[model samples]
Target: METKIQTGPVSTKAQMQTVPKKKFKVKSLLGYAAFVGPALLFFLVIQILPFLMGLYYSFTSWNGVSSAVEWVGLENYLKIFTNDPAFFNSFIFTTKFMFAAVIISNVIGFAFALMLNAALKTKNVLRTVFFLPNVIGGLLLGFIWQFIFVKGFASLGNMTGLEFFKMPWLGDETTAFWGIVIVFAWQTSGYMMVIYIAALQGVDTSLLEAAKMDGASAWTLLTKIIVPLILPAFTICLFLTISMAFKIFDLNISLTGGGPFNSTQSVAINIYQEAFQNNRYGLGTAKSILFFVVVAIFTTVQVMMTKKREVEA
Candidate 1:
């Protein structure tokens, strides 16, 4: 029985390979720790701490600057739901803005993405031009639009005789609502477009080819095939639009400053006014918590509902 004795060279090579494998496992574990530890620590410090503090402060009657936090239980929350008319008004305005912004922004964004995705000579440059507005700070964008609505539009109206441009865009209730919508759409459409474009690009070419072979019209292809396939992107865009619209503050401040009568104030602006401006810290904290809950609930319900539709489609 010639037992083939493994050579020392072979044993040495095997040991060398094993040594690298062991080192790799240890190194990978260390790398994971290095990456995850800092992130977890930051989340604890920045996010968790503030969240806990906010929750604690919601039960207190302490003004934001006060050292004495007198716990008043559910009084703050009760006041908002029971005694607060302004809160309700802000809610109404926020809901309306959210509906309008989500519809217009997603529609325009999806439209632009569709057109740009269709090969055109100036598509890249066009995308850059369209997306440039989104990169500007919200406050700056709001101020620029303010000038356009206030000064530029007046000049244009004077020159071109367009009455609509001369209307009180930032001063009146109806016009202010639309003004916010217009600014929001302009600022956000590019972002939504980028998402839609990526989703559109990911769609299977073969599916489109089959649809074409079946003599599906362009409209039908878009309606039945393309739209259904990009439902995930729709979910994301809808979430972004809804959250951004509800929490709109910079544009509201810069453009209207809750103007003409707090008619254009979103929930965030209203909360700010209540807490800091009015010194109702407890009530404001309560409102903030409620706002968080409302957004979370609405977003969750919307995502689940749309995800179901996506599956059905």
Candidate 2:
């Protein structure tokens, strides 16, 4: 007891040695901040801030032109739910259009991809021709197609004496809906075709050759092998078309202008009319919020489903 006892357990030799800590590199941190800070700042200022503001505005009775913003709470949302048949109609039209456009566009794109995947000498030229429509601005494309549907088709109809081109492509409700779908598929398919072409090129040729050795038919090879391999491209093209079709504004506006008794009005057009034309900013924002939720759900479900397929494949 007289001998001095250690106050605590013996320390390890390594512990006795001073372990150097990582130096805080202000230079590295500054470098990271320098690169990412501007984009983060702009995103906050442009997108996030506007969205938060819109959320608050959706709860108020603020006519955009007026400085007097009355806080109306859920009145705008309640009006949309109880009194808005036009909004529902517009949503219905948009949903229908989305389905039709997605199907036709993907089909045509895949077909174009298959065509160009072959060793045709003119494939490169055709690819450019196909993708050119996608380069044309949507508003201009819509206008050009509008002229074709209204006038050029009529002239062709007269020349050919066929009822197909004679009917008012953008006049009647049924035709107007299909007219939009047609133009959308034509413009969009080319872009999707390029994606498919890229995906197709990446496919393993050995697998195809092996299938050929196994006496696999073209259809069988495509359905059983190639399609699964390229499912990601399908996912991408479908997502793009679905979003584009749902938010169709410039094209719908310039082409039909929601004509044929507003029968062809899309949800985007409805929201635009509510906000700008009707001067109901609060109600319009409410509709937009609702639209955002629905579209988000649909696209999320689609992506999840396709992702599962990719995993399985």
Candidate 3:
């Protein structure tokens, strides 16, 4: 029998010919560009360009209307740090509000989630009712609550003879601070509740049942098991509440007008007033840049810390 030998070069050439290398398809590239180009262009034009301009303006002394924008390097920043007491006060108020709002909203939201997680007849309706406030715009919510605080509370106080309701909710500084806190918590808790509910639903039913079988009390299960498993939800809720509280403008403006001596003025309102009201565009831009840095630092730290906890859990 004659052995048929296959030549290596011939076999290699045949294999190479059988499998063709793919060329970069201009059609596919163009298709992708068509899909993504408009959004990218819009973002550059609307966000990135404006941010760059604002950064440049921060170093200049440009009152919004003036044709003369003199370079005043570091002067705006120096003024904010050294002389701007109102801006500092706003920062302090914003910090206080952030803590209060985050805690209260998360607590209430988590509680609502737990309650709704149980088999209930009215869960759907209750969820809708709770989330209704979130759908209302912040400005509208502020105005509505302003009326409620100014008029409705007084009416309820008269009918019920309750001193708590009768107090000037938006007139006094302390009350105004707490008043904003209440409205913030009320408006935000439902949204946080929705997030918590989604997280809660993702918890393994078997694990919960196993814990119950092991005689884990509700509080113990919550603290030891449920909370640990859903730490990501906490992180998200905290981030949202922190950002909202820090950037609180419309609510503060409409509700109290940062009144009772500017005690409730938020950093956002301060920036707006500096830029628009005072026409100190350079100073406002400087403050805004500082504000952005502070917010970035805070959210970054919070996310890092919470992410560490999440991993450990």
Candidate 4:
């Protein structure tokens, strides 16, 4: 009885602790709302909404400005596969462009990265100069190259009497493709170089020293030590190059407008023509959706393959 009487008031400490927990949960919810709310809203409104709308319109016939949209089921897709020669041509063109751009860009970029990594004078300035083209807008760069290809280089050809520069870089199918590849490589290599430079810097100096102590040549150090260690960078660079090559649009447009005879047309340009020029919006949407799937699949496979190699390395 005496011990029971000692407990005069019940402890409310446990209840008080739980009150702060409720407040903390509310505070956490509010914080999340403050941080992520705006971004989520914008993403939904801009990207997700358009994507869903595109999907809907792909199954319908609308002239892009019409009040009425008629459902055509799978007609647009079927027509794209069976009847659209332009779509196939664009696909073939895009593949060719991708192959050339990826190879040249990566090769040149890796080479530059290696050179810059060496103890050389003016490496930083060289990096900045190489990266300047990447900072310039793609459309602007395209136009600049167009001028060089037509007006500037033509003038140089006249003065030097060089047959190579005399050929129509943007007019001929063979030369036009190479022109695109060359410009793209020039523009993007700097960015890739930065990545490779970082990777090269991360390499263990001790391992390099050990290789050198073992009398390994420069080529052997690059092949066995440098290359193997920087495999992750290779994976990233390849992924970026592949994606950029596949989705190229502004450069292709400004350089040739898929012309001379649509010989250099890319899938993006083809979609633009179908949607705007021909008023086949549904068909264009269908093609775009297919293009998106192809790119997604290709990028996914490439990343997986490259990542596996990185692990093996």
The Cα local distance difference test for each model comes to 0.93, 0.93, 0.93, 0.92
CA error at residue 178 for candidate 3, angstroms? 0.4
- Model 1 stretches astray by more than 4 angstroms: 1-32
Instruction: Compare the candidates by TM-score and give the number of the best one.
Output: 2
Model 2: per-residue Cα lDDT over 178-287, one tens digit each: 99999999999999999999999999999999999999999999999999999999899888989999999988999999989999999999999999988989889999
Candidate 3, residues 1-313, lDDT tens digits: the string is: 9998879989999778665532235666787799998999999999999999999999999999989999999999999999999999999999999999889989999999999988999999999999888898888999999999999999999999999999999999999999999999999999999999999999998998999999999998999999999999999998998888888888889898888889899999999999999999999999999999999899999999999999999
RMSD versus native structure for model 2: 3.0
Candidate 2: which stretches are off by over 4 Å? 1-21, 24-28
Cα distance off (Å), candidate 1, residue 35: 2.1
Error of 3 at 227 (Å): 1.1
Error of 1 at 118 (Å): 1.0
Predict model 1's lDDT versus the native. 0.93
